[model samples]
Target: MLRSTIGGLLIAFLAFGTAAAQTYRPAFDPGALKGPRAGAPNMVMVLGTPHLSSFPESFDPDRLGGLLERLEAWGPQAIAIESLSGPQCDFMRRYPERYRDTVEDYCWDPAPARAATGLEVPAATAEAKRLLASWPEEPTPSQRRRLAAVFLAGGEQASALVQWLRLPETERQVGNGLDDVLVARLETLEGRRNENTLIAAPLAARLGHERVYAMDDHTADAAVSDKEAYGKAIMAAWDNPAVAKRKALDDALADEIGTDEGVLVLYRAYNRPVLAQLAFEGDFGAALEEPSPQRFGRRYLGYWETRNLRMAANIREMLGFNPGMRALVIVGASHKGYLEAYLDQMHDVHLVDTDTVLH
Candidate 1:
């Protein structure tokens, strides 16, 4: 009799647990559901692609080719790129001829000539160098440190050191020292540089001459410098009386972006938020859990969660700008889960499976 009672109680507990889980909707936003009409533009397709590689062995053109084919077939009126930004847009609008000339200079400059080295570099590297060189002044120490971080994250230790040295004295301090931890991190990133480039190129080729937009608002590093200041700025913008009146229109604009053009945004999977929640709930404390299930119970989960939330928010806002705009967000694989879930909650957005694309 006691065993029967225990079993019944266990079943009840399980049912209650399931109910609680169901109640937890990460993307739930009452305002998004009915706040305003999304006058969607035309068609929006969001896609996530694999990372780029230096050599053919590291490349995955077939996967990228498939994505391009889909975009071409869809025939978007204006395809926005992940590489263009608002400031650049302003520059282009204000100085079309000068902007064209600058872009041409970068594209036309021989890799060896620009870097003043005989190193056989990829087009992305060449382009990045040109862009970096053309800036008004040398990068600040913080900027150099950020570049080092990028190199470290990308597994390019040598490049990180090279970039670090190129910066002024103040910036080099940000790297601190050539410690083992920093070295190992850079080595890992160096290994992945080839892969990063290969993934970005074909997509750029396909978008050809259209309005490829760079959505990065220069906020990541800015936030790093002054988090409170950045928050205040965003808040101030939001609190402006002019902005408050246009909230509905802004929401509508987001929707329009989704329906207008097929857009893709990429992010590293190791940066997701659910993985953080899982880690906090699991054995590991605040420290980043290792990438082993036996030790960390699927260590990459938190990273994936962080990446997804960020990417989804970006996609959602961009889509809100125009309905019917198809956006393709290319991010690390682990982030796929959260992005898929978040986008699914939207009224008509479709989440394309990366596994399907990979297969």
Candidate 2:
């Protein structure tokens, strides 16, 4: 009788648990409430790419001619890159304890431009906008040079490069607020092999754009109390089969990027729909299960998501100002999935199929 009573109670508890699980549902879903949006929808293509700096020293800029041709044909009215904005860097500078490394690595000091223009990041940014707002349709070499100087002062080197590139080779000399120091900086930027200078800036120039938007964010950085232990915990979590496979795939792709076809193939693989799930499994998923008492994995995941969310918001804000325009975003491969998912939730934004564009 006692055994039978115990068995009956266990069955009753299981039945109640099942019933509760089946009845659970969320009260609200913002993703489902996409609405009666005004004007034409914004079109965005997020291009996932490996950092060009990782390429071999022999990597020629001409190797990218084919990739550049396709992007130019896409004709994006606006271009955004994975770079920290000057204003954000300035803001982060105040909190040096948390962001010293981030600022040093990502933000270019505008001291030279500041000296030439006598304006800080804020004023220079405002001046760049004001000049563009009333910019002449047929701006002279002098005007372009002046704007480039202002853009440099504003901490937008890529945009400044656009102006410098648009000018005739002979007209690229020091003048129109661009002193000797500023001219030298632009010259150095022209030979840079990184994506912003080689890809985004050149593409913007080819498409007759005045500037490229910097939408990356790193303000999510937090100084861990036990930095050494935190690093060890995260590294231990990453030592899984999924991570090994991801590394193998990345290594293989990096080797094949010698030609145009190779570059396109690499891009296609990175932007595959399944790559997102694979990335989560190898990275954030593994981290979430880390056995560290400090919860370092969860902390890393939080920072990753926060950065991507802020980046998506910056992109969305840019689109909001210029509705119905086509925009292309260039970012690291890891960020592609998170950015697309976040931007998809917006009512007026339409994500262009990356595969279609790459093809």
TM-score on alpha carbons, each prediction: 0.35, 0.91
lDDT of each: 0.40, 0.90
Which candidate leads the pack in TM-score? 2
Residue 108 Cα positional deviation in candidate 2, in Å, after optimal superposition: 0.8
Tell me the spans in candidate 2 whose CA falls farther than 4 Å from its real position: 1-29, 32-38
> Which parts of model 1 have CA positions greater than 4 angstroms off?
1-46, 54-67, 76-205, 208-303, 348-359
Clashes of 2: 0
Candidate 2 minimal-lDDT segment of 10 residues: 29-38
Q: When superposed on Cα atoms, how far off is each prediction in RMSD? A: 20.0, 4.1
Tens digits of per-residue lDDT for model 1, 1-359: 99999999999999999999989877776435532255543233444333333123533334334445555554443333233232333334345444554334222222222132222224324434454555445455555555444433322333354454455444344243333455444344334443233233234334432113333221211112444553444343334334443344334433322311211222211223443333243322322333322322222334334545555566676666666665555443333445666666666565443333332
**Residue 51 error for model 2, in Å?**
0.5
